[model samples]
Target: MTEKQREEAEWESINVLLTTHGLKPLCLVKRTDLKDLIIFDKQSSQRMRQNLTTLVEETSRQQSMIQELIETNQQLKKELQLEKCRVVDQEQRANDLEQILESVKSKVSELEDESLNRVCQQQNKIKDLQKEHTALQAKCQYYKKKRLEQEETIAFLQKDIYRLKKEEEERIVTQNRVFSYLCKRVPHTVLDRQLLCLIDYYESKIRKLHKQRYD
Candidate 1:
């Protein structure tokens, strides 16, 4: 057997012997030694001391394990507190984002309303412009019709004026021919004088008619 196993076997044997003798195990102290244990039953006391040493080593190991567990628990608690703080920060950020989104939505709604109103106003303006354009088109058509009528009247008047000018020219030509025939046919002095007087009167009348026609 191993040394530690042999020591445990010896301690077990000593524990049995002490129990059979109705002896209770003694409390161990830090200063206990084999020399001090020599006052007791030798073999049993040595085994008891060895067992107490093993027990103290085991208790130290247990205390070390308990300390490790306490440190681990504290670390876990610290981490949990940090995680809780992060959660609270995230919640606050989420609430802030929600409020910002709500404000953005409100602003967007107002913008949409303004845009709708602008669109309506623009549409109304377009309709008014269309109405004005239509009125202008009517006025333009009326003016075109009046201009056409004036052109037609001017054309008719021009044709009438041309016909009257032609007639006046023909009458002037016939009167000139008649005056030539009268001058050639009439040769008596007194009769010629009377004819010249009649011719002069007729020329004055023609001149007045020409003046009236030109004016």
Candidate 2:
């Protein structure tokens, strides 16, 4: 065959092979450009699928991180509530201690007042006792002086009684001597002696009268 005819026969063979596989006939466009376009489409589809897979994986990781953060927030809120309750308990204890201290202070004040009153009363009692003691001492001294004076007067009176008794005994002895003389001389010298005796008796009477005046 000629060169053009051989070329047509090869094309006919290509067309027959495409028809047998139920493929469409090639268009008028260049084969190389067509092949390049198909390759580009396949590459674009593969890159899109890879990008979608990466995005899904990243989204799932972000969802897990968010869940963990939510759990941590709830735990922090619970701890805060417990701390508030503890503070309230401490405040109540402080209030109770303050009330007890106030009661003790009131008791101390009452005791101090009572002690002051007792001291004042004791001081007044001491003053009154001191005055009474002074009066008693003066009274005792007066009684002691009065007793000394009475003792002196009694001693003087005893001496006077002893002297008066001695005088009376002397007077009795003289009267006894005069009576004996009169009885013995009565018969013999009656007249003259009797007259002399009478005269003597009258003189004795006069002496007795003079002694009485001096006493």
Compare the candidates by TM-score and give the number of the best one: 1
C-alpha lDDT of residue 25 in model 1: 51
Top candidate (lDDT): 1
Least lDDT summed over 10 consecutive residues: which range in candidate 2? 24-33
- Compose the digit string of candidate 2's lDDT tens values, residues 119-165: 99989988988888888889888888888888787777777777667
lDDT of 1 at 37: 33
| Candidate 1 lDDT by residue in tens digits, 1-215 | 75544655565676676667555553333223342232335665676677677678878999999999999999999999999999999999999999999999999999999999999999999999999999999999999999999999999999999998986777656555666786665334776666655766787689799999999
- Provide the RMSD of all predictions against the true structure, rounded to 1 decimal: 11.3, 19.2
Question: Against the true structure, candidate 2 has what lDDT?
Answer: 0.65
| C-alpha positional error of residue 41 in candidate 2 after TM-score superposition, expressed in Å | 14
**What is the Cα-based TM-score of model 1?**
0.59
